[model samples]
Target: MIVDANVRFEALSALLGTKITSLSGGNPWKAAPALSVDDFFIQLILNKKTSYAEEFFIDEKEFFDPGYDFDFTNLSDSAACMRGNEPYVRPKGWYRMALKVRGKYLDGDAWLGTNGWRSYSVPGEWPVSYHGTGLEGARGIIRTHYKAGDGQQFGRGIYSTPKLNEAEKYCKTFKSKFTGKTYKVIMQNRIKPEKRQIIGNYWLIPVLAGTSAEEEKRIAESSIRPYGVLIKEM
Candidate 1:
């Protein structure tokens, strides 16, 4: 079913804390001016009013009721990474409730500086990465910035993975006192191609061989930016 345009737009605007005006000055989904998904994503990525972003969405189609198990047998490798291990919750087995993220990338910013920049690239062009973080940590990254030095296994940058299953391994679960339901949080990010370093199935900001602590922090923060928060109920 087609979702209401106003409902979608308002939900996004409120989450991102900014007003998102229609490109055609009217609801494109309604008629006259049809805004394609590409155009809609481009507008948010290039809009100069915000440094973070102005888009987010809740997938109504995904089940949110408790104890619902999702089947992942048909998912592609890029969508979910399956693994066999103890405490096994099949990769991407939970329904994706809400994904809060928008396309926003500013040139000459800490995340993507002016060098070797792609003028034609929008946020959608960037590679998708997942960062498993605590609920509180996710909040801090969304409101402010991602704090590095968490799992500096391969260096000193914020750790993330191209595989959702890899990220799931790092997620910390918490039981809500109010609902008695346990949940895990994961932050979805877009990594700068040149700024990230690959090391055996994981992606991290390249903290040069012998860089000082301060420099590593700078690189880590600039190399990756969180765009969405993925929540799963257990």
Candidate 2:
């Protein structure tokens, strides 16, 4: 269950709009948008993206919550409109489109899990603002509740969100999950200040499935490989 550190990450600025970028000045970000080009590296240069976008993952803090399918009641808007401190409004058309798909929203899950096409969006929709997908997309929020209450609070879902950082902060944080511990931060090449443009892009990177390096192999085998999947495997 140990995560292969060798695992890598990549991203696109937008989906379904011919996502493309141009490499302009000495500064990687001076680049402009091109046409239908898929540049995994653009995600690293833009500070507007999530930390995992830049190729490095900062370790985050583990969180806790008794309820599994909870919602952040403070916001005056629906669950999909809020991310961190920013309130994004999905274009009316996109919102309607998502509804057409009838995607099911997980309790505190960052995005719409539509027919297994998993995605986490700030505003949530067709234009699809995502750091990446799966674990890479859920990293930031994972830092929010690390070491939170040891037990559940009320329902079946987790309730939380994460703050911001310059890689250094999250680089050392760790998040505990029902399955295992997930840590994230900026990747190597994207750590330089100038290349941070894409790192700033905010998308919820999740803890892709894996085991903690610190645990004994046998312990991992006995305790669980993936917590939800019952039975033993060796």
C-alpha lDDT values of all predictions:
0.42, 0.22
Candidate 2 segments exceeding 4 Å error: 5-38, 47-166, 170-179, 190-234
lDDT of 2 by residue, 102-131 (tens): 211222222222322122433232222212
For all predicted structures, in order, the TM-scores are: 0.43, 0.17
Q: Which candidate is the best by TM-score?
A: 1
- TM-score for candidate 2: 0.17
RMSD of each: 12.7, 19.8
Which digits, one per residue and each the tens of the lDDT, describe model 1 over residues 1-234? 122334333323432334443443433333322333323322222221213333322222221112222333344444231111101132454333222223233443333222231223333245667656432343222212334457433454455677777677666555544455555645455676677666656665644456654554445445665444455556
Residue 130, model 1: Cα distance from true site in angstroms: 1.2
